[model samples]
Target: MPHSLLAVPPSRGGVVPALLAEGREVTGSHLRELAARLAPPMDAVAAYHFGWIDQHGDPSAGDAGKAVRPALALLSARAAGAAAEVAAPGAVAVELVHNFSLLHDDLMDGDTTRRHRPTAWTVHGPSQAILTGDALLTLAVDVLTRVPEPEIARRATARLSSATRGLIDGQAQDLSFEARVSVGVEECLAMEGRKTGDLLGCSAAIGAVLAGADEPTADRLHTFGHDLGLAFQAVDDLLGIWGAEERTGKPRWSDLRRRKKSLPVAAALERDCPAARRLADLYAEPEPPEGETEDRLAHLAELVEEAGGRSWTEDKARALYRSALGALDGVDMPFGVREEFTAFAAFVIGRDN
Candidate 1:
């Protein structure tokens, strides 16, 4: 059991386009029209949060994130032998919930930027951002109710609720990990499962349920999604340190500046090295020198690689990716669909940032 967290993903080009197209079809202008009818007095607020306009009802340069959760919903449905049309609403609802989480997370993490723009809290302040996130969550529930089938909505509500709880638990555990310098790799994996994997599990389960998949089939999809989510996060951790700014949308080594307890740092800490001592000292330093930030970050990267953290994390991600593919292999789905997912997984693993 390696204690490091860096992950190098596989080739992922075809995966993103498929997922994005599915999401676009599910939650396009037509859904927006439907949402408008259901939104009532706060319709404008919901619209703004969706990146359609500003507080004053003027058009704004808002962002639409990668609809990963929604894509899972649609893909799971496909794996269960349903057309994308039948699962569209469920996909929309999951995406709305994911965006809601992002809104609140940015605030909690004190991130000033999101989706290549200023974060909601950074521009609107904490109270409004909190309100916006809450509103989005409420809308997510509302969107689920409009899904045409009572049973599907009921199951979706349960799944989404459970996923939300898992995400909250994961974040709590992640924050807690920071307070303690040393932690086991097992605990870190469990934390990743909760923080990042649960929502993915829910995405697959909900899609399978809507497609009328058998219980066993749905369970396998759940497993696949969970493993894939873990792999995705591991790769993301790698990007936080050594990735290019253009691709990642952040300065290089921003994680070091934040002292985030990423897999690389944890791995370095687990090993006995002078660089580990230097890292400990750096962690203790109240304020990292503004002038030396880049140089120090480079040194930290060297330490991470030297401690075998980078290679270890990459290997773990590869193992998890392989496990996810194995889970998919056990299922009887269209070869083309499965190929698409495989490509997507590869893209996730091989992303530049």
Candidate 2:
């Protein structure tokens, strides 16, 4: 069984769960109502994705990723000194939007596995998968519209729309980078900032704004979210290269196999090594032999280290964590919230899965 929320320390000064609990109280009924309105096929697909049903819509067991976005929404509200429970619908809306993106991204990437199970696209066809993703996006908006105030709903929708557009832009850049021979660390960071960072930043900012935070306060929270997100992506990059397949549930050397232009690869370009040169040579090769693939993978990792990718990533994560914590430095945090937030940050970077 997955670890219970009660098992782990909170991520943001023991505020994550208090906020999450509030959102959950509102969300359970709201989500069930929304789920009831979805058409059968679409409902089946979404239910499966949410771990509420099997591929055939029968009851089954599955799991979802940490609802990080929702936590951000709730925490942002708390940071602004509001009852985050009052903004629960907004929190659920962001979570739905995030899940919708994950569904579409899995289809676009032809990724078969997620959370140790076949992705929606893997079991269903691309058309159904695409429809499912679209439906989720629509549901997110629907959830936002029910947030009890037209103006709040409108602002939340606008922010979400912008975040979604940024995600697409980032994904486009990521796919395009695969074909380009020259990619740099700066470009990689920009791509991640847009693709991954913006959504996270917006989640926190929108929450704060909805809770009536001043512009400066909201902006600080936004910065914190962006830094945390960038650090999260760096950790993810490291896992993609060296994480255990059993833990990560991804194919070993998956990035290398795809010739992905990740941060480590960008770092390696700064060095002049035979292995680095060989990686450049092999980039365009249609298919590399196993022996050669292993050799190249090992060398590329070495080159990345030599070029200081790991050190840079570590430093960046630490700096971001500090910044995130600093944002809360003088704020009167709720009981145990600080410890939870610190533990959460460490868990994110230290995770092998």
Best-performing candidate as measured by TM-score: 1
* lDDT at position 184, candidate 2: 86
Task: Output the TM-score of candidate 1.
Answer: 0.87
Which candidate tops lDDT?
1
Could you give candidate 2's per-residue lDDT for residues 293-316 as a string of tens digits? 666776666665666665666666
Q: How many backbone clashes does candidate 2 have?
A: 7
**Per-residue lDDT tens digits of candidate 1, residues 230-306?**
88788877887887776666667767767777776777777788877777777666664455467777887888778
RMSD of each: 3.9, 4.5
